[model samples]
Target chain A: MRRLSALALALVACGGGGGPTHVVSGVSPPVSAPPAAAPAPAPAPPPSEDASVEVGLGEARLCVRVGGHVHCRASDAHGERPLLEEPAVEGIDDAVSLSVGARHACAVLRDGGVACFGDNAHGQLGAGVGVASSPRALRVKNLASADRVVAGPLHSCARVGGGAVACWGENGEGQTGSSTHYAEAARELVVPTAVAGVSGAASLALSRSVTCALAGAGPVCWGRDTTQQPIQNTPPAAAPWLAGATALAGGGEAVCQATRDGTVACRGSGALVTSMGPVALPPMTSFGVGASHACGLLADRTVRCWGQNYSGQIGRPRSEIGTNVTVPSAVPGLPKIKALAVGGYGACALSLAGELFCWGSYPGAPREGGHEPSIVAIR
Target chain B: MRPTQIAAAVALALAALLDRGARACSCFGPRPALVSPGPDHPAPVTSRVRALVPIHRAAGATVVLRPPGGAPVAVATASRSMGGVDLVELTPSAPLAPDTRYEIALHSPGQYPSTFVFGTFRTGATRDVKAPRIDAIGVAGAHANPGAMSSMCQSADTVVTLDGISVSDPDRDGAEIALGVWIADAAGRVDTKKLPVYWAVPKNGHVQLGRTSICDPRELPLPNAPAVTLGVAAIDESGNTSPVKLVRVALPPARHP
Candidate 1:
């Protein structure tokens, strides 16, 4: 099988277009300023493309494998149409965890550093950072051992080494838990932490009002509890029916747990903003959250997703099947895959099969971050 | 008609007008008691219609028929029942359909087009319209996260199709299904007519739940964070409604699981 090449997105590629950035619902506007007059001018990157994955079913955008890196689309689609492509990131290069929010996204790199992109008026993309076009990563102050990142509409949270969770960005609804405006770095989250027993967990999940974590055979969550996500200093509890899980992801109003048992369990309200319904999946390894849907990794390394299949983040255009595909099903025609991640309206996945594939809208290269000009160094 | 009959009607009218005087102190004279026109009267007999107009103008005075639906008919404005009352007697030129939909407009002097009666009425029907059945129900679209609220819809189209459901008229003699909806939370309540309800896919796709609020009816903001219950029901022409269709959706389980 030909390993699908990774889809790379160069932020500068899609030069700033004056088109109306039509965003739906909670999406905010981009906040980063244009790069200083120097380096190079970014060209117009091609718009993202989507491929049909099922017959009489919706399509999937991102593909991924377990324990592998992920490739994602920089742009997100509106309805069935692709919006941006290979968009840029705002933080560090080596992201450890990634999540999408209402208008921005957050990433945690291996060095306990945080990066952000998309909208920043809420300071969601973080404070400092660089990149030609994509949001460049800015070093968050305070704690440096950040391990996980989760983004909500106006807020972002990270799980640090000591089971302490810190959140910043928009504090409008006190979504950051603390009644403060902004917290630059990793600090003790105001809400109770749910990772008590699991001392050093590798992952954490955040939704609009809640956050969750997985450690050993148990997972825990806290916060406003819209759906489910870990807050801080809480013990990991097993999802109601979910047994043996490896990874987890949280949406604005829903949560999905990818289990070591190979099955994914999704639980939440049936509200329009929430993705409800039981999604049956083939044995899978991991899962990621988009604005409204969740994508999972299959044993075959192919990606399968269910719930709010908007923006083709589930791997295909929802229009391909009318309504949303809320059932865990296959993303057809995808070659071997490794890791998968969903951001706002787009998706990215890396193929252990050696390739990276992305669909929906993101702001970069169509195939393998194309041999673009040398990346600019942003300090 | 005998003079005695005429005298009786006049007396009744006088009595009704006098009754109104006690309730509201207005410059206008007393109101007239409404008496059903007798069979002996001519086909288009004009009778003084007992009415009460505002010290200014009545807000929504309308001439409604007993039954609902039929060929378009006309009403002739006779004499003013009372001075400065702006109340005119209406004479239907044609016999209204028995137990069917009929309408009459209040002759507003130079305002909007003759204002038609809003609700339908049946002449002498026995039963009320039957309520439409509710089928599948669920929420669609993006999930409710922090700032946004979740939405859901109920499917009545299928039942409407199989049963030929139509809007019910309170005055209609027979049956007609009518739709009414309400949403409530720990804080307050909202109605379907108030909240935005969208047509589902396909024809009369019925109604799916939505968060968008419409004009006459609007959604009430969720007060206590995390959850709310939605209720929907249908009424029949007889003024009967089915048990409210109800469902509750919440971000956090009402009870810890």
Candidate 2:
């Protein structure tokens, strides 16, 4: 039942302009109603509607999408700041979504345009090399409209108006879907370029050394297959299990697809089915894959995570459960979540009430910052 | 045996003895001309002894007072090969008495004559306890590849060459120097293990650089928070450690495909 002091809450309010600020509620003691023997029970209330709040996790920072604006806080630096406060992105507040990379972030405006900020050593900001690092968001060059955008560790890709995919930044491993190898091609592309052989891409997913897209047919991935995983070279047409996949997720060396049948099929580094053995699986609505782990949000609103648990990234204590969680296990003590986001060393869940909770070795967490999930205050 | 045959055998033995003497170990140190005191100090004074050839063993090396006065003292020796030269160093257990003359002797039982004086030295009145100076630190990549972007990368397994280290000792006392490098992450956590480098002396203003790959097991799998700091320290013959010189490098995250 720990409560943040009023002074601490005041500090969280100092950085950003006037807006609806969110605060974490303290755990309340259990209350008991007066016992009236054999009294009739009242009817239960109906379930509340899902809250609309977007949360993005970076290596050392976290941002929340609220009221058409994004507010961010860094672990090392105190206070919060508007993600689009820079002059380059001024007067633009129709932010619909945000994607955070290792050191940078990108936002998709309601007008279908993309603006990025932060580190650009490899032109990840899409503003070219001259603008090495920018605190303000810059419009992605030559990208008139974008339906969706996903930022990876060092690169970024966006789904254009016609479902066309464009990528920029570090191409060392051919993650940009370019035919040329990083050693032979320009290391950093200042502006976005059309991904070769890819059209009508419904969505995009990026991993450490690979990128995959959900196209009309199914999921196709391309990049460095460091471990010779199944998602290497062109699309994966040879696997029949991915024929009717509606969504795709990428990991360090693997890719998973959510099929229309509510089941998930994965390849490279072994599929979740292989880990779960012959047990019956609940219907999955979505998937979140990290560098070495994966999780699925079931239709029942419960989350089941499996794979590497080192640093407690799997929502359990490594010391208590050992290093690897071969099969899916329920994440205890977490409220029913609407979505989940897994990072290289941590994972976060967005509750139905718009509360954000995170676990594992990510920065700014209480205690050891791992072993257990805790509520995060994103004002 | 016949007299002529015996005489020939004696001659052969004498020739073998003379050959061993010819290859006796030769020791060297700071030039005597550089040890003058006061304003005429041509070079810094030092007590370290270096031999051209490796000494047999530490037990066979000894330093004694001149004129055969006090008892000979057994000294410790360490051998290492550097810069195409084999060097054996001699360090006394305790400081030699001031204003005293000393001679270093080497005895390689079966290889060389037992009674050979490697070199002679004179102890100065002043003691050198100041640490060595590290002027600057420079870093570069091991290989020059046209495709490689700026030498540094987001991967923790990047190899870099620290060739621009400039080190100098005021005493000019030791023939070898030890250098250490450490890395610190943004959270102020320092890598427990340090990269160690050894360099041969008589550098004459020439600096010897070493190469090392940056891979710390403790570093998180994610990209470096913002930057990583590298620090280098120099250690002198007198056991004095220099203040660490630091360099900060920005590591942007690796781009995903």
Q: Candidate 2: which stretches are off by over 4 Å?
A: A1-51, A75-92, A130-133, A180-188, A225-241, A260-263, A269-280, B1-257
Candidate 1: where is the Cα deviation over 4 Å? A1-102, A107-111, A125-136, A171-199, A215-218, A226-246, A259-262, A270-276, A316-320, A361-379, B1-257
Interface RMSD of each: 27.8, 30.5
Q: Looking at model 1 chain A, which ten-residue stretch has the lowest summed lDDT? A: A12-21
Q: Report the C-alpha lDDT of model 1 over A226-297, residue by residue, as the tens digit.
A: 333542221233444333434445554555554433445555433213435545565443455555555655
In terms of lDDT, the best-performing candidate is: 2
Judged by DockQ cut-offs, the docking class of candidate 2 is: incorrect
> What's the TM-score of every candidate structure?
0.38, 0.49
TM-score of 2: 0.49
Which has the greatest TM-score?
2
Query: Candidate 1: deviation at residue A375, Å?
Result: 21
lDDT of 1 at B116: 23
